[model samples]
Target: MCVQAISNPRSEDDQEKAWQAVCPLVNQLRNYYEFSIALEAVVVDLLSVLCSDEMTSRQHLEMQQSLFKQFAEILDFTLKFDDLKMTNPAIQNDFSYYRRTLSRMRMAGGDDIDKDLDVNNDMANRMSLFYAHATPMLRMLSDNTTKFVSQNKDLPVENTTDCLSTMACICRVMIENPNYRSKFSSEETVLFCLRVMVGAIILYDHVHPVGAFAKSSGINIKSSIKVLRDEHPGKVEGLLNALR
Candidate 1:
């Protein structure tokens, strides 16, 4: 019924045996439908469940919160390409729901209004809700990757280049939420934004090594930022402009 119920691989021997038999047919379906389509479906379902108006009651909120926490734990477990390869449409739906839930939680936490500012102590408490709700999910995702590597054994801890993906996701958030920049004075908001930037920058550095991003992209950034200060005797200077 929940995303967590469907997202994990069956650990039982009989379940794995069943999946092993179905793997071939699943590959056939993969040929007809790209993996990304399936990924999107999963995201959509999870979002629907999370944002449903039916979950408005305080008691319902606590229940959903608990379930979300569990979903985060599931993410921590190792998820393999094979583990996700199943032929059962129903099972696949479940798995997709789980993955989508993780993505939704991650983005929502990062984009929370109260996360980046210090306007009030109450804001800090509100920001804590994001962390409290998300820590488990973060741990789950991390654990899932780790478990995947452990299971594969031969897989190396190679740097993964995810800059374009990160940038694109950030762009989507910025475009969708125009007020993000205006919350900079809020302590919770600033902390969250800084964390996102720092994490992204670190990932980029790890992937490209030797500051390739700075060398390749900094020039464009600087040129785009340049502005003319005067008209008669034009003085041009590059300045970091706020989007807000």
Candidate 2:
């Protein structure tokens, strides 16, 4: 499904075709382990598309919400599948990650707090453009998933250590130049990407901790952290010290 989305993407026809190819897999994802992990991959890809600075449009935001609603339904439904046995590490891990992510999204959307007009518009625009291009794939994923994650509460997090580390790196980058980070306002977008990266790294580290990141990337991370501290003392001294 992922390969098809990348290899043959141009028109709605292509998108729908690719979606159809993967739509049948949802029924096979009967287990919580399969469902949550797959859902995580889908959410990450969708977020990457929506968060990119290059594509900004209203259509993308609507699509993002549409995708979110679908996933939410899936997760919500899936939450009821099997017993809520916190003792099962797989179930626990998947549930935790889902809750954390959903909470983050809702918070970012300002569902609870009062919205800032400019910030909201910027976020909405970026998300919309992302969905315009990525929705078909997400739709395919939505079709494939059997369970839905609930939105009223937080997405779960089985392990937050790597997430914390990635966030630390992101803060370092943002403090260096919060004003010019991405297409959206420089400040929060950096934070948002940091959050995603952290979550991804956490998942990766869960599988391959020692080499989760390339040596080059690690060096870059180390160097970036140093530069941030040296050039932007106020931003880095307190915030990104843990990243290194």
Candidate 3:
């Protein structure tokens, strides 16, 4: 089902229909009680198709919008803020939801995030255009995930670790997309991306102990942070310190 639908969303109607079919599954998958690496991999692989470099500019833009809209559906399905998850003694199920969602978003925004090879001629423009469609959900999801992680201590290390990794990807995309770079200074997207990066670094260090954020995220978050440091050093001081 995912393979056929994501194979090529060439039209708006097809995109919407494709999301309608899968959004429920995505919602159900988000709140898994146990962290199954297999199911997570499957979700990542399917969403990667929409966010991959293997599409036309038009298709990319449509697919990004469709993906986020589907995310909003999942958000609507369950935005539980109560202590039910904590008291119920099922933090894994509750916390894994945010971890999974952020992981998926990071993967989706990833094509142009860190890979220099992904950019060629018209590719930068395509990513920037896709960003315009992608930023709202990206901003919302990252912020919510960060907030949730900060509040919950017993959640698995994977929840916080995955959140940081994904945020790094998002920051990388914001910095690299030249078409949208002009908006970097004043855009909420830029501010949120930086904040998320800082949070990710702190979380990574706390969770992994010896694991370095720069080496762990590899190119995606590192290059993205480099772009910010080169362009706006003062604004990114928090992110810089967190990396160190």
Candidate 2, which segments miss by more than 4 Å at Cα?
A: 1-179, 213-219, 223-244
lDDT of 3 by residue, 132-235 (tens): 33122223343444454455455554544543455455556766778766776665556555554554454455445355344554335557557667756655
lDDT of 1 by residue, 64-182 (tens): 66543333222212121212332124535432343343345447675453343222224323322322321222223333333433444442323122321233234234423548656
Stretches of candidate 1 off by over 4 Å are 1-159, 163-178, 183-185, 209-212, 217-244
Pitting candidate 1 against candidate 3, the one with the higher TM-score is: 3
- Give lDDT for model 2: 0.37
Question: What TM-score against the true fold does each predicted structure earn?
Answer: 0.22, 0.24, 0.32
| Decoy 1 TM-score against native | 0.22
lDDT of 3: 0.43
Instruction: Give the alpha carbon lDDT tens digit for every residue of 45-104 in model 2.
Output: 544443334433234445566653443344333322311221233332332332343345
2 against 3, candidate with superior lDDT: 3
**Candidate 3 deviates by what RMSD?**
21.0
Error of 2 at 164 (Å): 16
lDDT of 2 at 68: 38
